[model samples]
Target: VYVETGTGELVPASLQRAQPALLEIPASLDAYLKSIGDKSRNMIRKARKLGYEFRRLTPEMLGQDIYEIRTSDPMRQGRPIP
Candidate 1:
């Protein structure tokens, strides 16, 4: 099991596991692109070349699109869809 706390606080001290990612998005896309490593940047470039454009999200506009995008693949990596 995993337990998380603030920087100094800890409960169970003996078990130290790798912490899960905490994403902190930059204010702009360019700033974000600059922050990631080269391999990730290359993937983004390839995605852009393949015409995968970024869409600004809105409650009514992107709900269906997001649903289709996420549910299109029933199995991703080695896990089954929830």
Candidate 2:
């Protein structure tokens, strides 16, 4: 079953849980390829060549980077950002 936000479609019974929820992906073997910059993609390829499997951090971690960047802006701190 699949679900998406920002749409008014009815939920499928098969996907319905006993509690409120958001959609989630269980896992994927190629998870490391998602949400990556070009440098990280190259690093992943190198690691795989060396018999290492890279794991991508969750989008929540990416959100943390955005949040930190926003909060740390010099203009946001009430002074001219030099």
Kindly give the number of clashing pairs for every candidate: 0, 0
Best by TM-score: 1
- Model 2 residue 53 distance off true place after TM-score fit, in angstroms: 2.8
lDDT score for candidate 1 against the true structure: 0.83
Candidate 2 lDDT for residue 1: 63
lDDT of 2 by residue, 12-70 (tens): 54654578877666477366457557898888789889998656888786997877776
The number of the candidate with the highest lDDT is: 1
Per-residue C-alpha lDDT of model 1 across residues 1-82, encoded as one tens digit per residue:
4446877555664664788789897999899988999999999899999999987877778789878977999888879778
lDDT of 2 at 38: 87
Pairs clashing in candidate 2? Answer: none
What is candidate 2's local distance difference test score? 0.70
Root-mean-square deviation per candidate: 7.1, 12.2
| TM-score on alpha carbons, each prediction | 0.42, 0.26
Task: Please give the distance, in angstroms, between residue 57's alpha carbon in candidate 2 and its true position after superposition.
Answer: 17
